[model samples]
Target: MSQLTHRVGVALWGIPLLVIVVLIGGGLFALFLAVVCCLAANEFYRLSESSGAAVSIGIVCAGLLPLVMHFRPDWSLYFLALGILVIALTLPSHRLENLLGRFSSAAGGIVYPSLLLSFLVLIRDGAWEKHYYGGMVLIYILTAIWICDTAAYFGGRAFGKRKLAPVVSPNKTWEGAIFGIIGALFWAVIAGQVLKPVLTVPQCVIGALIVGTVGQLGDLAESALKRSAGVKDTGNILGPHGGVLDRFDSLAAVAPVFFFYFKALGMV
Candidate 1:
């Protein structure tokens, strides 16, 4: 089948499963996210290792601590500190050359997709007392991101001129970026109406702004990583979409910001 076929096929099944898991918002959701973060971290580790950074499997294993510990945020800091310490101490026993590179890359794995992705659990379970509101918020943000990505793709194809960052992502352009943000805002207004008192139109607008703008930054960040590593796609785990990290790069960046947005408004 074609790349676009694979993309649509994955989306057809993946989006529904994701929506169901988000709505569940309990141990099931936590477990689901845990698996995702782990997989993403593994992909990151592989990419970094391929780029001459010596990332240990232990780092990927350690990354799971913060993800699980997010459920009990009381111990989240302690786990993060411990994860770093464990990685640091264990690094010396390895090849001994480029020790710092190994340590930094390994520790970074725990933070990037692992630590950042953990915030999704926070957004899903900690955002609202009403419980379902958290799920709705997640679904809304996800849809906004999708719309933003779609708009960027088509908009760039139709009217791209100035490069957004030609060195990092050649296909991206200023026009596409603007179109993405606009698409996100439009979805925010529509979804906000559907969401009712749970989220006002203004709040959704801000959320969309964050997802649309910052999420693209997340994409570029991953692209930079791939460019440095001299790879086209991160991995083929998602078929045409690439690996777990590639698929969720935007979420890896967006979740933390969105969670904080909820926290700032005292919604969490």
Candidate 2:
């Protein structure tokens, strides 16, 4: 089957499931995120172990950290610090040598999808007291990501010339990246007007540029991870999409950035 066909088929089911979870936005959303973290963390640990890194504790932390952030946002930093310390101290029990490699790999697994993706909970749950606007903001971000990815894919296929990152992601092109940014900017304005009208025109444009660029970079980062692990896809969970990490890599990257962007502007 064609890539486009596979993509559309996946979207048919995935988009509704995601919307339902976003609308629910409480224990249900937390549970959804916890499951995503677990799956992504499992893929990460599998990749790390493929490179001979011993990382078990970090996997546990990755699965649990999102739930903690959902329940106790205040304690997240302390929990991260405590998790790091514990990982550092317990390195010897897992592997007496390669302590640095083990610790760093494990820490990265916790931070990437676990810690960064937790900000989606903040965007949906902690950002505002009102459910409607908060949910809209979450939807806006997700829409921006979808727009960016779609634009990039079609744009690259149609007009790709100069490689964006020849080493990291050979398929990406500068033309595609530009189109992705344009798509994000266009959607940000539409989303602001139709969904919330909370952001100014300038804010929408700037946020889109930032989110679009960073989201692409996040995709590249995951590509680099897979390249390092000497694999094509992270796992087979999503068939044509590869895995949870494959689908959510851009989201994981965008969530923290979007959260802080709104937070800095006092919008959230």
Candidate 3:
């Protein structure tokens, strides 16, 4: 099946890169990944209708992703403000049949993805070290997402009886969601035990829970965006898996939040 082949192909492409980042280092690696984020953001905006809200390229630019990667907490504040400002500016002073909700819709599409994804760069620079565990954290976050998603898939297939969100993602079920949480927590617990020297168990558990939940929510959020834009997937760059953006959607939101917690504890 294409699905099985797709999974295998993705892992083949992804796992080697994961090893490189984790073992070699995460500093320059993280910097190099900025393009991925930018393209992802751009594609998200491109998918929106002309009648959508105004996409604020300037807003995302003003907040300079690289600057945030340097680990300035202040950058996030500016980024947030810029998002709001763009959104506000995009609002129509007057609504009419003649005037569509172009500004508001595009604003939402752009602001939504950028605001969450910018945190990835922030966290990439802020995690444990600029180099060592930063890569590991990135891999770890995605691995956690994978674990959650994998468990959800199997669990749902075997015991899915209740709908989770039929409108947004019809395939997701309550059973799948619950099992996904358990799987995420289980991975976090194991990582906590093994990686305690770098990170504590309690922190691992809590961070995993927070990241996994938010990551799933981020996926759903992106799904909503796609649906609103009248698209099935974001792109087809990665064969059956869609684009890198589709793959990283969940992890993007997780990176910054988890990185902040680590920073607060002086891990970064």
| Number of the top lDDT candidate | 1
lDDT by residue (22-135, candidate 3, tens digit) is 455435554445456555655666676443344545335423554454556566667656665665555555344434455555455444455555555555555453355665
Residue 161, candidate 2: alpha-carbon lDDT: 99
Predictions in order: lDDT: 0.83, 0.82, 0.67
Residue pairs with backbone overlap in model 1: none
Which of the two candidates, 1 or 2, achieves a greater TM-score against the reference? 1
- State the RMSD for candidate 2: 2.1
Candidate 3 global TM-score = 0.79
lDDT for position 259 in model 2: 86
**Can you tell me which runs of candidate 3 are displaced by over 4 Å?**
1-3, 22-27, 50-64, 71-110, 127-131
Q: What order do you get sorting by TM-score, best first?
A: 1, 2, 3
TM-score of each: 0.94, 0.92, 0.79
Task: For candidate 3, give the lDDT of residue 253.
Answer: 64
Cα TM-score of candidate 2: 0.92
Q: 1 or 2, which is superior by lDDT? A: 1
Q: Please write out the lDDT profile of model 2 over residues 46-97, one tens digit for every residue.
A: 8887233335667667777777878898898998888878877777765567
